[model samples]
Target: MDRFPEAFKRFEKVVAVEEIETFMQLRLAFGSWAGRKWVPTERQIEALNVEAARLRLEGAWRRETIVVRGKPHVRYRDVRTGRFIEKPF
Candidate 1:
């Protein structure tokens, strides 16, 4: 019995599902991007600070240690790989 056609269809569905899952995971992990004119207003900044303080209190903003040039540099880990990287900007 030749089940190649059905198998291929199942494989295609699996690949599509995997791709969608990856996209959703990335979106959740990195968040949406802001536009060029998206400067935070005073109120927004204050709100952000409040949220950040909440996260900090929850121990979510813990500092990470990294080795650089034979010295330890405290930095945040990259979200994708859990590796320390310098801030791009």
Candidate 2:
């Protein structure tokens, strides 16, 4: 991200990384939104609800949810060893 985007700047273009990420999180947690209001998709909402319940009920939800990197980077945990690893997004 630190590297200068010369061509991008010349074209007056900007990426909405934060907004897209926010939308994804919101949608995953609450189905989807529409018309300035929340519109629930039954399957998606139900799946999310079920996963939440399972995680909480199984005591496997205490681990931190890492803020993953973007593009060619991936950041996450090593499940079996409980170690944090950084590869890319």
Candidate 3:
């Protein structure tokens, strides 16, 4: 079966070759925000949550949640920047 149904395919975008290798390295490092080593602050976390909720309400298909530090946090790729944001819990 197709993991991403046809209806959801519109949300997918083609990533650049430079981004692919960087993305893999970051994933291996365990989902950092744009591959940054430091953690996000409480204010940033709250902002990310709000942004995620807003995106969902706007019918964005890319908004998602991920577990970090044993708690659920919002994760989304900013359309304007093309950067993966995994807000640490």
Cα lDDT of candidate 3 equals 0.38
Error of 1 at 70 (Å): 54
Assess candidate 1 and give its lDDT: 0.38
CA error at residue 55 for candidate 3, angstroms: 1.6
Provide the TM-score for each candidate, comma-separated. 0.25, 0.21, 0.26
lDDT of 3 by residue, 3-71 (tens): 222312222232222333232242232224234633455543443334333433222124567799999
Give one digit per residue, the lDDT tens place, for model 1 in 27-52.
22222232343354543333332333
Judge candidate 2 against the unseen true structure and give its global Cα lDDT, from 0 to 1: 0.34
Top candidate on TM-score is: 3
Q: Model 1, which residues run further than 4 Å from truth?
A: 1-32, 57-89
41-64: candidate 2 lDDT, tens digit per residue: 543343333333333322111123
lDDT of each: 0.38, 0.34, 0.38
In candidate 3, stretches whose alpha carbon ends up further than 4 angstroms from where it belongs are: 1-33, 57-89
Ranking by lDDT: 3, 1, 2
By lDDT, the better pick of 1 and 2 is 1
